[model samples]
Target: MAAVSPSPPAAASIDRGDSGLQAYARARLAEGDNALGLAVAGYRAALKQDPDRVEIARRSYVQALESGDGALALQSAALLDGAGMLPRDGTLLRIGDALARKDWQAASALTDRMTQEGNFSFLSAIVRSWIAVGQGNYAPPTIDAKDRFASLGQRYLDEHVAYQALNHRDLSAAIPAVRRALVARARDGAALRLTFAAQLAGIGARDEALMLLPADHANFNVARAAILRGRAKEQPFTPAQGYARLLARLAVDISSDPAGRALGLRLARMATFADPLGAEPHIVAARLLVEQDHAGAAVQEAAKVPAKNWFAPLAQAELIDALAASGNLAGALALARQQASVPGAEPERQVRLGRLLAESRDFDGAAAAFRAAQASYEPDKLPWTLLLFEGSALEQGKRWTEAREVLERAARIAPDEPAILNYLGYAQIERRQNVEAALELIKKASALKPDDAAIADSLGWAQFVTGNVAAAVPSLERAALGAPTDATINEHLGDALWTAGRRYEARYAWSAAAINAQGDVAARLAAKSEEGLKPEYAAP
Candidate 1:
């Protein structure tokens, strides 16, 4: 009791305790948990103990609001306003939300308060512009808001605003916004300006839009000169360089956007006439043509690439497939044979040739090609799937015993392969001696690739033959969905539909099959459909 020092004062101890509580609350908030409520309670309690801690309470409240708690956000916003710590934008955002909810007086008051502060005049103008647009009063306020954005060096925003102005037919507001964006970021912003200017020209601002070009950017300079000279078509200064640049742009644009890819394909195809030796353009043109369903045209385009290029074999194979698809099997087989005989042809060429030959019904030649191809290449490098082609050719040639042996060996090598399983299963089904075994093989194939139309069709057909017509319908329907344009799947669907007593739908499916089926298969399906119409139509 002599020199006790008064125990350091109770306020100091309370302040230290508050500091510890705030730190714990902040740490929990940082972990992204439900700490906003805890932080709000802690900050409020601390503020009660130390009323001077206004800034600390304001910060905690803001953090709680930003964590997506609308109730907490409103409460914190109120506390910040009470403490005089609310930023202008924060108040504006809250007011904007209130306005969106049709609280007109609150929004108007917030706008007036912000105008008085003079700190967020630009944002206030933008909000006012949006309100004007919403109210259908697109006059002085909209123009003023756009001007404010233009003055702030926000060109992208300005250009977008200009687009909105144009949509409203406010050419006066649009011109200034477009001009401001073009002037502020001329180099990187030329392309967008060119588009806007082209539109402005369409709306009778020819001189103004033309003036935006020739602004030090090369693309713009070229575009402006073209416009002034009345050149409706783009004529590049250096055709090769221009084509190269266009191709580069196309490549980048096509990476994520299909419409861009389609445009790029058209541009590349046009470029190919000028740059005949540039195989890159030809390859892209071929791919685009394929995507466009001009398979024959794609084959012709792909044939221009030299066989020595790395992509030559792939191009040739694609061309052959396309030719086959277009009902030019003879031509496809000839191209395959020519590719096979070419000097330094890769081992994969043999597989391609064999497959084409098999499709053309030259089974002995296909088998010989596959055998020669297998002998010359390493097993790892050889596409083991080619073995299925040899087996299929043998089976079609009525060498069933050998076909079964070869397919069984292929199945062992590629135990999990859906293609091999489907081929073997279908082969068994065709032989009509191992319906149960074929069903097992087809089921395995379907399990591996449930969405593969070819495998699904095989499985459904196998099930149908095994007297499981009800189970087959869903599989056939799924197959039809997966391969809407596939002739075989359509034929299978027709059979399933007929068995399910949907005779009209079955006939429609058969008509679709007749439209899409190719070569012998097409003929066979058509004949079968005709037979089904007869009173004595019988299943093979």
Candidate 2:
């Protein structure tokens, strides 16, 4: 969820504590990134000083929800709702709670209130259907209700109809709705296909079930695994599984919109409430939590996935990311290593292992892990980004020739990729080979991303090496301005400035560069600042 706007506080709340503390907390929450943890702490401190401040209480609720502290959110939400100021998310939770208790009357009443509020009105049909099913009265939606969803809304409409039809043992009705939902959207068909496959399996239609499976879709892997298990067991989707599927699909759909995280969280939580035994719902909620920088909560959600479920490996992979994000890098690496050794672990886990290794500067180990990941892809269809990563690792390891070979192949496959062009061009310039060719490649890369500081630095260095010091100075200056603290860019700018007779500024730039420079570069920059450029750095 985006950070909440602070409500106007009463005079008593202001006088109760340092107003500055409350203001600081609000500012930090609004600032985004990893500030949620600190914001929560700040809000807690402020709230302790003024427990009756509804504004502060509401802000705490938002921070808690955004941080994926659902239990805390529920508590804070209770306070707000008790004060007759429950937010939209709180309303969703309230409705979900009603549904959980099989209080159809309360659920229907809450849903009506939600509709009146013009929030989550899209959920009215689904919730009503659930209520109907619970009451042993399955009401098929009217034609007008079905017609209201002819376009993109049709997907949700289809889900509602199919779910009700399934509960009523009306497969003929369910099948057409499933097909329309699947056929209408090229993307997001996994959940619909999964539901359809499960229903088919329910009726012993094994061939139809297998036929509905999509090829190589990442989001559908768990569903595929579940379908396979059903095939083996000769069974169908349980009612809880069906409910979980509906909630999962809704969560996925909402998550696609940039402003839908809050709604997505509510639906995911609802899914968990509706089907406590289903691992997929928890995994979905965990992923959304991770996206909002709630790694601790994400880890908690992932931990809820039963170890025996087919989704356990998926949970473990997500836990690896959560651990890393929560600043438990060693734990993440240990888990990654364990995951990698499993006989049939997913290739994505190995890819993750390589990234963690690369971050730790184990370049050789990272390259090996990357190779193992690459082996998972078909040879002819390897992704360009993968090559770029492997090439970068090789370059950082000082395996220059291998790096060049890999980068060149990447450039061929994705000729317009500015990163590949810049890296390959910069590598050529660094080795002092084919200066003119390097200049052309860097120029192409710079044209593609004119404001990129690293590419600008490469462009400047290439010009300086080819005896164009005057021409190089402007580009180098731009690069330094764009990335003021990057040692290499500042050092490059310093060299160009000295060559252009700006000697005093050259020393100033070198001093700044020296702060972050290391090893040979630091020594070289020191010598240049005190005396002048070595013979190597002088104008050609």
Candidate 3:
């Protein structure tokens, strides 16, 4: 994401009288590299120079908000609004600008107009609530029962306003509100709990607050410990902070659904500027940026979360993901290791480290991390899952004896878990150990999870290894359908297809496997595609 060094615009385009073409070309290049901030800048400059270009102004408005360029968003949004072609999110930018300047009348007027629109009335309600706070007689918005978005609205947005309305003024109603929000699985679950607990402690009800957090849950464990130490206590949100929270959560929710993704991202970028110091907005923005494949922007957003914020640890996880996504695997691993080494780190932190290590193909290190997590956790907490993780890592590292022993322990603890059953059965079949028992285990697993691709693959491979070619083909085909891009499964399917006399189809399957295959697997897949299945390539 280097600065926009615009290559010379094509002479023909310049002669065509488009002066902004050079800037537009630079913006396109930045967009290709996922440098959203740089792209936004180029688009902004292009829009300024070519104010009549509605397309440029619209793109600038969206990119400006996506890049957290509040001023640029306002400029483009105003341009678009003046042209009478602004979208709902562009209007939101204008409204946010009004809110920032404390122009309550303008903000309220914009929000009221939004209420007349067919959708996003919930968002308008949030904006109106913020404006009301400024006017000194604030009344939170109520959810409209008959509205088409009532389910989604009541789920998260209205709960925040309701919680604020009841809990801010009447402390007695806080517990019920918190319970309802938690039960509804509010979008900002951890942050909501922290805020609720903080409000409890603020009124000398520390005991009640402590009781709300059970010792066993990972995030809650950290909160409980921190609360006891008189640390990580967030103060009550101001009107601005509350407004930001509602917008951020709503933005994330909207971005998750495909129909309104761009609008959501634009709104989220606005949320970041609304309360710059608030952790929730940055966390939401970072996560959304990561999902959108803008790793650089995600990293920048995650870094904005203050260390003292309760959401800092969660933000750090986002930072690690952003680093990994941006191809800085070593840096991501090093940071994960550093975080995992924090004194009295929770089991979840260790689990996260193990996951990162496993992704990096450092199986031995991943196994160690999973083992450490297992040791640190309470006796009944995800014990079998941790054992399965360590066992899989050991298997990948070729420490099969240890892997077998650990996997057996997991099987004993979770006798009916399909994953454990499939893993142990598949490992045994691959090793030519206890074929009859392994087949039974695989059969049971398939019965338990009939639609699981990996389980189907394992069962098919089990049949192939035992020389049941006719029985394996259907299961192998089913596995391939469920996991179209899985190289190993495709290779297995090719072997079965070749054995079943589908020569051309077998070659096609092998070619598919070769698409993303690497090293020894690539060589094997290529050989199978060219020479058909050899004795070495197929199961015995």
Candidate 4:
């Protein structure tokens, strides 16, 4: 991911002939250009004049890490440590460096510091285990049976322990750790299987390793194919790489949860420092950056994903969202179109395009893309949800005839789906077509999803449209009471009240509708409050 800039240096500071200030301005400009190499040099030079500027030093340290300048980063880390202002992730940086240099002594010291400072045990314990593995002294981290990521973490730890044991020719110890990691996540996480299988193969248990990766298992197919063709090799075993993988995965887990996102961002940045060539860390960082409303930075971060990386698809997906979040809908659409046009993936790629188009209100394009997604399926095997996707797109586009056919198809496929029933019934109610049948459909939907405000609204409106004003009054009242803030439901209630000759209460409902209504709906609600419903709109 690209290094993020803080802000442009002030104009007065430009080329001030004071070398430190000039270097600082240069550093800031380099950061703005996403040139971390130049930024690192500029910040390093500027820090000579004022190494204690917490802000500059911090920024310098960050750029060094982002640029994979280990020497520069460790130097900055010491500077920050001396000032007692080291950032939370600085310790991890120093630890990773120590492990990489094979200085297990220094790495142990760093881990001890993390433990003393009360870094989350879930993380620090795992880090300690890896440091021990690097030193050929394997100590399994204590398991937290309840930790959300414990299973995944142990799977990784067991891989390292097994790999190191294999190197030590201890088949008894290696075999158990290998079997445990393999069985713990047999159906997912290719990395675990790949790494463990490699250890067995290294120990000349080739047949047993092959047994762990059944070629027909969907999860193993890609790895199997790559291995067969000699195009892929299992990751080289190193405690440093294992540490990076753990950090990257943990960053993803934490960032995915809203409450943990703040710390997740820091871990993501540090993961990049840990694995400079990695793709996952960049994507995770980009996603969290976008959530924090830094879309431009996210775009830069995601764009750094190598085009040929296995995660290229995910990176592109992130780019589309980041572009859209930054209000570049046109760019988003363009990228979505390019991805959807890829030859093989079918439904997923096309569905992405359809959703993007639908969200942009280009329902015609959405309908077309969704239809294309169904081209791969046999008529009898069409997924009901995909049909509903296409139906809803057509419905929103005001193509009712097209929408009704597809939606009815979906309802047949999934007879108990209340949302499908409500959507189809309400649409028919709006057009006054087969009102009696539509009403029955809505009644069934309401029975299935008894408390859904929208379904209740549909049921009441269908009653009102069928000239059952007596029944509509109570039904509409129930719907309105259930969804007090729904403009459409309130308007329906207003219509029923006016038909029942309750003029004052009718106006009150109309006023309520107008409160949150917008565009033509708002105007119509306001007019109804003043002029009352037309006679034609009233039920007999």
Highest lDDT scorer: 3
State the lDDT of candidate 4 residue by residue for 1-540, as single tens digits: 233246654434433354665677678887876665567777877777667777778788877766545667778888889989887678887877777778889988988887666554446667777787877777755667787656555655665566666656677887887787566544324545655665566556666667767664433444455445555444545677667766666666666689977667667776766666766667777777778666776888899888755456667878888898889989989988988776554476678789889999999999999998898799999888889999999989989889999999999999999999998888888888888999999999999998888898888888888878888887788888788988888889898888889989999988888889898888777777777898543322
Task: Per model, state how many residue pairs clash.
Answer: 0, 0, 0, 0
- How are the candidates ranked when ordered by TM-score, highest leading? 3, 2, 4, 1
Give per-model TM-scores: 0.46, 0.72, 0.83, 0.63
Worst 10 residues of 4 by lDDT: 9-18
Mind giving the per-residue lDDT tens digits that candidate 2 earns over 93-145? 66666766678788789879877776566666666666677777867653344
TM-score of 2: 0.72
Q: Report the number of backbone clashes for model 2.
A: 0
lDDT of 1 by residue, 1-540 (tens): 122222222222233445534443443353243233344444444545544455655655454432223444455567678878876545644554455455555666786787777754544554454445445555333334355444442323464566556646578888887677567544324345555655565555667767765543333444455466655332111223222223323433453366655444534543453345655556656666566555656677778877644345555766777787668889888888887776445556777788878777788888888876776657666565667877878888889999889888888888899899999998888667699998999899899888798898888888887889898888888888888888777877887778888888887888887787677767666776776643233223
Local distance difference test, each candidate: 0.61, 0.73, 0.77, 0.75
- Model 2 misplacement above 4 A: 1-51, 67-71, 78-87, 109-277, 288-294, 341-346, 450-457, 467-540
Q: Any idea what lDDT model 2 has? A: 0.73
Write candidate 3's Cα lDDT for 303-361 as tens digits. 99876666777788789889888888888888888878876666767887898899989
**Lowest summed lDDT over 10 consecutive residues: which window, candidate 1?**
1-10
lDDT of 2 at 401: 86
The list of candidate 1 runs beyond 4 A from truth reads 1-264, 270-276, 287-335, 380-382, 484-487, 494-540
